[model samples]
Target: MSQETEPEPSPGPKQENGPTTTGSFLCLHTSPPLHIALHGMSALTHTRLSRTAFDLCLELLEAGVKPQALADIVVHILEFKEQFN
Candidate 1:
């Protein structure tokens, strides 16, 4: 008699490091400019602001923002925001 094979484990849902959908939506409406500014500053400053942005992004992600959407919004805001220009 042949031995029975075991079933493979199913994969779990994917998890993101930052910005949940709800958080991103709130962030988009509440302070899109500020969000974009921070993301920009983080890139320019390359130190404190960057870390802060990363932390905030993580918080937003945990709250529910999609990574791609959050990144797009951040880039859009950063490009147009006067301070960065």
Candidate 2:
């Protein structure tokens, strides 16, 4: 059964030195829902994939999700996908 999660706090401005609040996100440890979304996004054409990734990140930022971590995950996934071609 799926358990409900607590809502994440909205992202704040970056802190100087030490970890920022969002730093705790750690993309590799992302939840299953996000992993599914990223996997679906990876199926698009090259240009579309890039644009879709960017748009998803922008939406995540607006939703107060971990944009930087999502961006990193997108980049890493894209890089891994590209290497096999």
Candidate 3:
């Protein structure tokens, strides 16, 4: 019997400047990014979460996770919340 395996997802088309396109900059900054919102919590919590979120953002960007993709995921989560709540 042959085993079937799922293919790894592609990161869309190649941009001239890699994944850090102008659109990505806008998506990550023009609107308050998730890490920025972490400031609303208590000072201690904010410091920890913000630092962690910032590190995760750097890791994601390094891993080729586009800012627009992150934005899309946030939208999907919001939609899910709206539908359920």
Maximum-lDDT candidate:
1
Per-residue alpha-carbon lDDT of candidate 2 for residues 1-85, written as tens digits (9 for 90 to 100): 9999999999999656432234434242234466566556655544346545655664566457775687678779878997998
Task: Kindly indicate the candidate among 2 and 3 with the higher lDDT.
Answer: 2
List pairs with backbone clashes in candidate 3.
none
lDDT of 3 at 47: 33
The TM-score measured for candidate 2 stands at 0.36
Q: Tens digit of lDDT per residue, candidate 3, span 1-85?
A: 9999999998999655323334333233333544355334424453333455555654576456887897577567657777998
Q: Between candidates 1 and 2, which one is better according to TM-score?
A: 1
Tell me the number of clashing residue pairs for each predicted model.
10, 0, 0
Model 3 misplaced stretches (Cα beyond 4 Å)? 1-59
The 10-residue segment with the lowest total lDDT in model 3: 18-27
Predicted candidate 1 versus true structure: per-residue lDDT over 1-85, tens digit per residue: 9999999988889876444356335444345575678667767865433456686775676577787897887777666774665
Could you tell me the lDDT of residue 37 within candidate 1? 82
By the lDDT metric, which is better: model 1 or model 2?
A: 1
